[model samples]
Target: MADEPDPQLSVPVGMFEDIEDLKATNAALIAEVKALAAQVTALADGGGADPGEALGGDEAAAGGEPADEGEAEAEQYPPFILLLDSPAYDDELRALIEWVEGVLVPGYLAEPSADARWCHLWFEHPVAVARLHAAWLAWQELTDPASCGYTGPSVWHRDHLDPALRELRASTGPFAGCTKGEHQVGHRLPGLVPSAWTHGDD
Candidate 1:
């Protein structure tokens, strides 16, 4: 060595070790970032769970499914449940079922037929949801204070409830051969040929 350089003056050996440690930390952080990005993309692309069906932050944070009230609250409420609507087997469709059982079934839908217990099993029918939604919408509007009490019920029955219930409770449709004794049976769907169960003397 023509001129001996001070060892301490040279880039310290400890610095090299620090750089290696930094590199590993950076690599790990980069990997974590990439993973987080991928998760974000998946959530965006798939249109994450239905808002009505999704659980609250607490359940999600704890990695648990909603139970009891959370599950009940999310079910068929907020209209977001429409996207995830399954039949009765799912049980997550509580709102629609509750409305049907509490309001439509009790107040409007005709009594269940002797052969077919449509009232008990209405949630099983896939088409029942759309019909329920229509009726529920009418109920919300007609029951609102702005609606004229005398005309609201009549309009709902004529414009929304009757037509929807006709298709829903039609004999040839899902709940076949079922009818409310007080109401007409064999009501035909739009495209289907009419049946001969007209209300007698009403």
Candidate 2:
């Protein structure tokens, strides 16, 4: 109406709007890529991803289960101590002992009795060491707040702790014939019959 609005200028105005829209889209895409990169970096560094930001709000809200499960899955756990070699195994065992004496024994173990035996030299017995190490590893995983959450300890007790204690403290368990103060000095593993291939017609 106002002098026909200058037809040539109209095209430029429309093009300008399109360019602005494209710029906004590009900025949003860049932000998303940056966020993804940050998450990857965190995971590589053994630092777990942030739950709220990792999956985005809409996806997280859509399904509550994935986010909750992802928290534990994202955590990195150490390898079994028995799998390690020489000094590493020795080093880990020392730390394991610290946890056993400081946290495990004091908090969980019962008084030594004829039916429920214990040994001060439990480490001397390979089977006892293996069992305790397994329990200790489970303890580390379940007790972590970032991994197992609130129900971890209860689960550990039911699935790991009780079973190990039953075997370790039983009258005929690894500490058999051993007492709290007096470790059974001559404890020996039961002998196994030789294989036919090795002792053939001897």
Candidate 3:
């Protein structure tokens, strides 16, 4: 006898209906998300009226200052106070401070102009000059091994053992990446050498 055909073989219509329903639901969810995103962006760009005012909160304040005493009290630390007070010589003063950090401390010497402006270019801005003085003291404290020995003073030894002059010369070796026309700002001297240097052993 021939093999009988099997019966009850059928595609699940309910599964396809459920899948179609899920796709519709997913598309509706995506559209709703897009609309919510647009509303958030509109709120951010100040397109609509103030919601905070309607809600009766601090965000409605017109001025950008702190809303409460606690918020005002939080802003005690200001890094740019000196710069704002004395903006004129800020750049030169910053350069001078950086030079002292990179050159003078490594050379085991203090800036000659502890009180005067002969060494530093900008003496006019008192704030900048004062910051330079503070930087010098900080540099001294940082480079001294004893001052910060408890805080792992490896950096102190590194700077002290290798003098800045020697460090400059060392940068020209095969392993060193220095090239012609690549002058480092820290080592440049503005004035002419003294005449006493012409004598062999003064």
Q: Would you list the C-alpha lDDT of every candidate in the order shown?
A: 0.59, 0.76, 0.45
> Candidate 3 clashing pairs?
none
**Per-residue CA lDDT of candidate 3, range 66-173, in tens?**
345545676653333233324534664566667755775566543323121122232333333444444444455675667576553455445543333233234332
The residue ranges of model 2 lying beyond 4 angstroms of the native Cα positions read 1-76, 190-202
Clashing pairs in 2: none
lDDT of 1 by residue, 1-202 (tens): 9599877789978998999988976776666556555556667898665433343433433344545656686664444233433463255467667778787777765555543235456555545655776677667778776755768877887888877877765655556644443322333234532333222354
Error of 1 at 146 (Å): 2.5
**What TM-score does candidate 1 get on C-alpha atoms?**
0.40
Stronger candidate by lDDT (2 vs 3): 2
Model 1 bad stretches (over 4 Å): 1-81, 85-92, 114-119, 147-150, 177-202
TM-scores, each model vs. reference: 0.40, 0.55, 0.21
Q: Give the best candidate by lDDT.
A: 2
Instruction: Output the TM-score of candidate 3.
Output: 0.21
- Identify the leading candidate in terms of TM-score: 2
Give the per-residue lDDT of model 2 (tens digit) for 80-104. Answer: 6656667877998898889889998
**Model 1: clashing residue pairs?**
none
